[model samples]
Target: MADDDDEGGFGGLYEDGHWIWDDISKSLVFVSDLPPKPVEAIQILAKAPTGTVEFRDDVDLIEQIRFRRRYQRKLKPGQEDVITVQDVKDIALYTAPVQIMSPLLINMLHLPTTERFIRALILYSAYYLQIADEMANRIMELEKKIRTPDCDILEHEFRDNLADLRLLVAKEYSVMLIGGSDMRKFHHMGPAKKRRSLSDKDARLFETLLRMCVQIVWLALGRKSFNQIELETNRIFKSEIFNAVEHTLKTGYINNMAKEERVVLLGHCLRYDKKLNTRSPLMNEVFCHRPIDYRMMGLGVIKVQQMSPRLHYMLQAVAGPEEKLSELGVVVGILGMPRSAFDTMLRPLPTAVEKSKASMSSTSGHSSSKSTASMGKSTTAAHKVYPDVVLPRKETRELFYPPSFPDEPEKIRPCSETQRRRWQNRLMKLLHPHR
Candidate 1:
């Protein structure tokens, strides 16, 4: 509180480093030796603006120059982080879910294999469109900095092209797996042996196209991880089918076209199933056996359920059982025999085999002594390529349902009561055939 003096409305009220000079309202002024800390400055460039100059101190000038240089460096060719290895490792994105309709699509969905390919083609197109749209959007944003109007026309064109592509692919695929002599072959073949009927060249070509589509989809969508795809490719390459193909190719036994057309179809199926869907069917969990006479195996030579009917019959004649006997009646039963006939045929074989087992075991012991000698001698080649089944494990790791991902510990899919009972019945039939 202050009382007014003779000549003063209010004399300057001096405190620590400031003086209050105003009377109606208090205002303080201060002076200090320490200079204020420099704050970082940001400046936005104008769109299509005439060149303008700004005045700034040494620090601000240096900061602006450095920012400009960094921006310029980013615009340089081959400097994009998106295409770099380190960025790929860090980002690790891939294409999303796709249902790889089995090659047996005709049997399973009553849809042609070409229809499934078209679906996959649509997925690939989706990926391509997404990438194009993203790039277009980025360009639009960048162009906005240079020119204010939006790229509405470009956006519209992209959308139209995408729609047209989908429609065109769908329409074209409708006729691809049907009609013509070449196409009729595909339709007439058994669902299980469709791919087998193809010349190696055709198969490989189809596989290559599928592989490319899958690869592109993954690169664009970033759904699955890179490691999963790589492992799948490696597994495919190491398969017996690949080996057989390679062996024949090297020997010139397989034509160049057939050699090129590979069985990468199953690999893709496995990839889509395991990496994308939990309910993926066990496509590769199939068994094919051939009985041979040489190894003291009680059943004489026989070939079972081969992909090629011609090859199956050929091998049967050359190496199959001399006597025409239904070994376990499995083949005949599987061929849709009458239930009563199947039951009647199934009995007594096990007892008969049991009685012969003791003699076979003693002979098998003798054969084991000569196993090393037999190992060097080549047995007739009856190769049944089950790509998903590893040789070391006779059975699949996932019995009823495929795992959605490799890391998934649970092997079984959650099923309805009916499905669970159906699986139980099948398992019982398989494991305890006598029952």
Candidate 2:
């Protein structure tokens, strides 16, 4: 860490209405006017200059031609102006694709560990939402401008803003590091005189937030997966199981293991997948099903994932098919497991897929075409694990990612009543946990 007066110092953490740190008292402070609530912050972001540019559905062929003509730039000194017929064709066919920032971390309102923590969480959410919204808006602007004469100028502006946005993101993360310190006093009213790094639990939360930022940035850059981003920020602290859960969300698998190796992997995934409400019977079945079952011991999958590396090495290849256990050593080295676990799961002759397939085959098809279509749907559904927690898809799409400009009246109102109720419930819990 740098000195308070220098660059990357504590001075950078202070913003008029976000956070402040008092040197004499050695305590971090929250500004009286914190950032807007999550939803309101999003609304604020959506009103930015570029944010107002929207996707339109009524652009005619003549309008596209006009747009293209406007974008034709004058050649500079020593520059060749080469416009091929293909270029014209491309301009005529171009249509902007609707891009969306992944909502997993953006919309999620976690239960803060302390009441004081809520302010920091909300502030961070505001910053994250701002950057995400700006990036999306800039993209839309670029799409529109690229077909007009001001394309070059607009591109320059977009580039400059992109750099500025990255800096804002860094400052946001810094505030989290500073804010996570314990600042409450004996009376719990004023600041404490002790300064320290974030606690273990708080550090985990910070790491999660950092990963979210990275994921969103990568998505905005048009990357399909966060693998590169995740690897780059690997040093950020997170429990292995939690890391696995994130990996599963981005990629449909846990660390690219083979089918047989997936038995334990899938089990861990099921245990850690945040989508499923834990009390569900399916969760119990997955917990008891085998390889890494922690039911009898009363331990959590996360605890096991973070256990001693030496213990994992011992249990790495205890049982299971030869092919699946081949890389089990490496898997165990990274994620520890219990002894006799793999052997227990291996005895079940048929895999989950085989069972599902057999059941489908047993049912005779009413018609060939219907059967074929049904099989395809079933197979796809079998693979896609729909999230148990359904977000306000309608609202998110309209506010954060409207599919079309001049959004229809029906599309704009009441994003999701369910989401509203859930957020209220979470807020109540955070504000009055004991109640």
Candidate 3:
């Protein structure tokens, strides 16, 4: 809202590639849409003994991108460093689509309306998860039930249900968010990531989902349940998933190369667990089935344990008198919480489980982060909704990264006049939908 002459202004927005930007106040500029949190442009500049951010307004085109960058200081006092950016000219002045969708507003890709949207998504997600949980359990039960009797008649009955279950499984999509990819070359590699074509919005979310798919598939493989359900994940990563990921990644910016890291690490997860190259003090590695990252959901069975002490009783009560207590172990295991509390209280009933497992659509499927902990959060929630929403993901090739600005640019805030017009065009569609 401030003027270009004012610290952090919009003058550059109105100008073409040829515009000067000097509206930087010493205060940290905050743009909710920008990733890894609002970068302290002044702080990054303060690190420079002779750092500066000035826009060059002498371009051949009208959309003279207003650019910004600086030399930086080291952790040690009085030490200065120049982080060399080879395409500094292009990068420093590029305002990108990733930048445009970085804000929470653009997150409304599927959430056309607000207040009801989140609750609706939560309800939708809860129901979806409930079904997934049921499907997983049914898959377990059916496998156990059918395997006990290897008669031809039982096999035929199982096959019929198997076809139906597969169709059910394919009805919905599950999302996963990988934090980063190993930018470093995987020479000691076997199969590479697959190059499944994805839009920028999808690029960010699907890649993570792809990584998770690899892990989940591996988990299923580990459990040795090869033929448990109906239509498998269409987007499920095969050996080609990694190839697709690596193939696309090699085409992106070096800084953005970490996407490959996530997929590669996932490949490693398929073969190894969390102990991919590094080992824990306990010599323990976390497996995909028991992802340490599952804590993000905040409302899963894991969190339920924190709320009560009688969950174990509930789970036990769910089993029929003929069923052993061990059968319901998965209900507790997938949650990774103290089962004695709530699950113990609301014993999972077979009929209830069967009802929840009934097939429902699942569209399961974000950007960068500063700290590793928050990275997935910024870029992931969209993937949380998965194949349903149409959002942008990082593409394999980005012809233009958004030009750098004095500070992080806000969502819908254009760095060049041309971009403003482009956004305007999009706004027009939203304002006047063709019904």
Candidate 4:
């Protein structure tokens, strides 16, 4: 570790050649090499006044002096950005992700322990879940208003509100996905020495929060099937959440676990997958039905139900008698599986038509048509049957007028006296909620 008062020291665990001591794993890890700095002479020359007859050659030396002075006043850890539990709670209640999530995420990286990180993650997931539920309710309300003939909300107002809500949902979901990816990356880097073992209680709560995140994601996608969500949302989901989950399942931070513990952990992963499959049939067909050989268990096959009792007991102990696991939402279920298992499970299986085509020299057009028809049926089945809040078939002109020009300010209409009174009452109600 570098001394705090040492001049030109890298500070903390950082050392020369981009190597840093990982206190948690008790090992030295290689950080990435620093980006190349521009040559001082060239930079100084480039910044010289245009077409100058004479330029000061000592500018580089002067710049170096200034840099050294600024470097001497480097911020202590106390001066760095800090986020508190209350700050996160307040942000979740009052602000949109667009306004604060990025800075909040950056500050969370400076959190000192695994427990604190998990707590922050849980708060973020809860915020996302709340937003998703609200959006769903708002959409339902909008649908009712659109159907009511006497509704006073103009077409433009309705469209603009729906667009704003959808945009908000997308932004919030993106932040959540990024946060989840960063959490997995941080965990994979090894735990901080101060908080080596995650408590079983925190672990279970983290798992529940992850499940809630998945459910919120599904809700944001309009509760559509995987295939139906393939267009806009699928790419983002796959790139961020799917990739993060896949990577974590493959290379977990379990280097310190004993052999028996590893086996039990693997069993838990399989058991969770089994339970999850029961909840999502599509996932069951995609990943759980296939047989996987666990080399950690000496290439032995373990039945999905073999570990059920132990997992149930663990859940029961953590959750107590009154709570149901189902209330936590959909399980992300593959967090602890090995990389080989994940790859095998994700591999696409060939259909009967493709198998027959390989055997024959040429395939009949009938086979292609039949496959297309089946695909259409699946698409239709996956598609939302209800009227979409976003897309309406009937096109109507906006009821609101365009903005008035500065020269013709009289064209700008003022709010009606009734509308002004209504807004005043609403503001008063907000100010005095109990009243």
Candidate 5:
């Protein structure tokens, strides 16, 4: 029987046998009719490498297998991937570039609310820095043009562009400050319902963001204007908000300040005291207190309320039938949101009452149809077609406008001429300061 088995198995010591060469062992081995176990097959394959394999040790091989399998593991049903600190950092760094930053930052707003605040801080900081660099470059160009003896007239076009740029910067600064306060409140009373302090990394990022805010303000409004506004804010708040801000602006470092001090300083920056009036024309325009409840409009009630008041006002203002001081395009451009998205955001959501009413009407209509059918009455209701009132979607034509430019030029006279005169006066003062 053994002789017969050996002859049948091709010199193997197995019943119903086959023979296979073991490349690693460099010998013939008997293959059983039953297949090898997965582990055994893997070991055999690992040992009998056809080519050079990087994993030399069993531990390394196991680690490689785990690494590959890690990505393959699927989440359980209804399980959401949690956004960790690392994820936020990656997003922040990815959107740090100037060219791609704005749109990406705008998109971050659509992230899960849990992650939005931190992302907002980091991305907004980077954005502020980008705009600061741009404003600095523009200012340098204007200065160079002024110094040029051949350049006699400060062109309306250039001045207009600078003014618009300044206005954009101012609006952003105000929005940042207001948004900061909202973010703080949000985190403190987050979904967890626990007071969450910033991690060391987040704290550092927040400090840098606050510093950039100060820099943005300083650059947008010149030192003179900045000083006047700071003094007024100090008087109104009776706190060292702007003083700390000035120090941060000048030093470009907040490491010296304690965390509590930094927090207080941040609070001051984001604080919008109704009585507080900077009195400077530009400052007043930038930091106006017009508290409007967006919940009434049923447009992102919670999210919008938790956002910057100015931003809320801007959204509301743009949704108006009559064009307001801030154009939808300008707001959209400043926020880096696409026109379509901005319009969608402005679109009102139906209230719970309206939804219930709609359902009730639908049910009643169905019941009425059933009864009408039973009665054998074929009465069709006449539907009235109302004229569609198209809301004018205003698009910005020029890259720049006078500071006082309104949405509708026809309805409201543009103060471009006055702005031009002011620009000329400013240029004249720069040229002959002694006079």
Candidate 6:
């Protein structure tokens, strides 16, 4: 490996040719596609007099532009290609992250809904799904340019199928049961009489759907789950959210947060559950700062959980079970009840009418009126807008844990003694001057 040799010292291919690892060319690399890609980073060899190497916006000149990929995990002996945790986890150079928290978080840590997630829309909704579709396609083209030995490529492979995935998820939760003349016809019949709606159950289930969507989107964006983080992290996220809410309730101020803030908080909260040490302010902002996303509708519906006595009685004021319910009708608003109570109430009643109505447009009622930048796309808005139980699947594909029930918990484990000494020396280098 001579210095002048440009043949094989980690030379990666590019449109112009190949770039040797040690080659100090005056070039910059721009990394974008913020979401879902763990390392949405930009770096370049700054040819300035200082000759610094750092993030740059130029694509052509940059020497390296590796994407955070999601591909298959490597397996153990006799298990070639078997997906292991390392193959999935190691797929990061760097990327933006949001904090996530779920009481159900630990229970279903390994198998979050990401595998079965469907964020789709119809072809007619050109403006909405078109750009998304193009983005997905462009990602595929870029993927071919580079190949890492790890697994983030799997997530990259998912880019093209975003639209159809949503459709498939809708079909999974379609929950339509029909027989007789209604079922026999080639032509379609009307919606089911008894179906999921706000009033059919308590607000929690409705809210859970919203929470799940946010969690899913957050997960898709590669953020760590909050409950899975330190117990303190979870506390911080909730505290921040509540504090922000309190500010709004008491005074009038706005606090907005980024995806990173969420992840940091969740991580911090879980970091010191035993001690409850000082929390990260970033988490405070996220929990409280209202992200004006379509998920808000689901959040609002979920908000039914916090309903004052007046709101609860108001729901009861609605007409009898036989009455026709409008979109925001009582049936759609019963999101606060506990699952058992909600289910018990619906044991006899009919489900929401599963009308094959054309999809709702412009808004899915999940978004808050205040924010323009909402959840993933329009389709997810309507998907969770209508009430549904959306229980966690039995066989979740998440690599870390199983679905619903977790097996033995595994600690991340400490670095070895030799590795610890090397780590300490490195840390000391930045903090302490030479002897």
**What local distance difference test score does each model get?**
0.28, 0.29, 0.25, 0.28, 0.29, 0.25
Which regions of candidate 4 deviate over 4 angstroms?
Answer: 1-166, 173-213, 216-224, 227-383, 391-435
lDDT tens readout by residue for model 2, 123-227: 222222222323333334554664455644443343332222222223323323344222222111123425343244233334344444343333222222234
lDDT by residue (1-435, candidate 3, tens digit) is: 245565535343323333343345434333343346553121121121100122222333334322221211112364222111111112222322222222212222212121111222222222222233323333335546753444434333332222222212211121111211221111112114343322343444433322322223322111111121101122122222333433433423212323322232112223433423632211122222322212122221122232122223332321111123233332211122212221211123344333323411232211111112211112112112112111122123323323531232212211222323333444445446893
Deviation in Å, model 5, residue 124 alpha carbon: 2.8
TM-score of each: 0.18, 0.20, 0.20, 0.18, 0.23, 0.19
Model 2 spans with C-alpha error above 4 angstroms = 1-162, 180-198, 213-223, 229-435
Model 5 CA deviation exceeding 4 Å by range: 1-86, 89-111, 146-435
Model 2 lDDT, full chain set: 0.29
Instruction: Look at candidate 2 and give me any clashing residue pairs.
Output: 55-405, 70-148, 70-149, 71-148, 71-149
Span of 10 residues, lowest total lDDT, candidate 3: 365-374
Whole-structure CA lDDT of model 4: 0.28
Candidate 6's residue-wise lDDT over 268-359, tens digit each? 21223323554333322223333212221121112334333323322221211112222223222222212222111111112221221122
Number of colliding residue pairs in model 2: 5
What is candidate 5's lDDT per residue for 213-251, written digit by digit as tens?
A: 222322222111233233223222223333443343453
Q: Could you give the candidate ranking by TM-score, starting with the highest?
A: 5, 2, 3, 6, 1, 4
Segments of candidate 3 deviating more than 4 angstroms: 1-151, 174-200, 216-333, 336-435
Kindly list the per-residue Cα lDDT of model 4 for residues 65-144, writing each as its tens digit: 54334321233364422222222222121222221112223333222222222232232222222222233333346646
Candidate No. with top TM-score = 5
**CA displacement after TM-score superposition, residue 19 of candidate 1 (Å):** 99
lDDT of 2 at 115: 15
